[model samples]
Target: MTGSGTRRLGLSRVGAALARGWRAVSWYVKELVGENDYERYVTHLRRHHPETRPMSRREFERAKLDRMDTDPQARCC
Candidate 1:
């Protein structure tokens, strides 16, 4: 219990540190990219992570159903 509490405290400390770092980075990014171009960042990600098979609504539904069938225990009562 003591170890778990210590680990939780350590994680919180790390999160705080990361939040501070991210704030600094975000401010720098805002200055570098400007407010207007901030939305273009998503296009950059999409360029890197191009889709293979474009999913239709039906395909998505079928895939979800198949997954639920495969894992009976995952289904809620």
Candidate 2:
């Protein structure tokens, strides 16, 4: 291949790598922010306890808050 073609190929590979890295970072950020928790919880409930109903988002958040309030170890300044 010519010099320009080699440079283009290198740039294409770099762009793909950057895109993959961005996607990974975005997923991590979503998980870190608890954005995926509700979906995961729902999936878990459906898989493990299908007979029981899953909590609504509001109920889930309220229950989580209540638990945090009751647990001293869960507090952070």
Candidate 3:
């Protein structure tokens, strides 16, 4: 292969690796911050409680905060 061709291939590999790394970091951050909790809750409802309706994001967050307020020990800090 030509020198420029090999360089292009190496650059492409680096770009792909960087993309995968970014996705991993994004997913980790979202999970750590409970950003995906509503999505997970919806999935759980569809699978295990098909008869129940899932809460809207606003309602879910409000309820979650209310629970935490009632049980201060559940707070991390």
Candidate 4:
């Protein structure tokens, strides 16, 4: 029981980290990809796997704007 609980805890931490990484990737995609390709990528990730999380272009853009506002040098445009 203790071992299984520990495994579950570890999995939760991994899941949280993956979520954060996916957020960064989504932001990068928003900055780099064309609209159609960005939508396609989001849809592909949503359709394909349980490990990857789906993030909308809008969400990514909003997050990107937020980050840019927070970091003086992050705004490229």
Best prediction by TM-score: 3
TM-score of each: 0.40, 0.70, 0.91, 0.40
How well is each residue in 1-77 modelled by candidate 2, as lDDT tens digits?
Answer: 89999999999999999999999999999987777888999999999999999999999888878988899687563
In model 2, where is the ten-residue run with the lowest total lDDT?
68-77
Q: Clashes in each model (backbone N, CA, C under 3 Å)?
A: 0, 0, 0, 0
lDDT of 2 at 58: 90
RMSD of each: 16.1, 2.2, 1.0, 13.1
Residue pairs in steric clash, candidate 3? none
Stretches of candidate 3 above 4 Å error?
none
Comparing candidate 3 with candidate 4, which one achieves the higher TM-score? 3
The lowest-lDDT stretch of 10 consecutive residues in candidate 4 is: 30-39
Candidate 1 Cα misplacement greater than 4 A, ranges: 36-77
Q: Measured by TM-score, how close is model 1 to the native structure?
A: 0.40
The best candidate in terms of lDDT:
3
Candidate 3 C-alpha lDDT tens digits along 1-77: 79999999999999999999999999999998889988999999999999998999999999989989999998887
Task: For candidate 3, give the lDDT.
Answer: 0.94
Q: Rank the candidates by lDDT, best first.
A: 3, 2, 4, 1
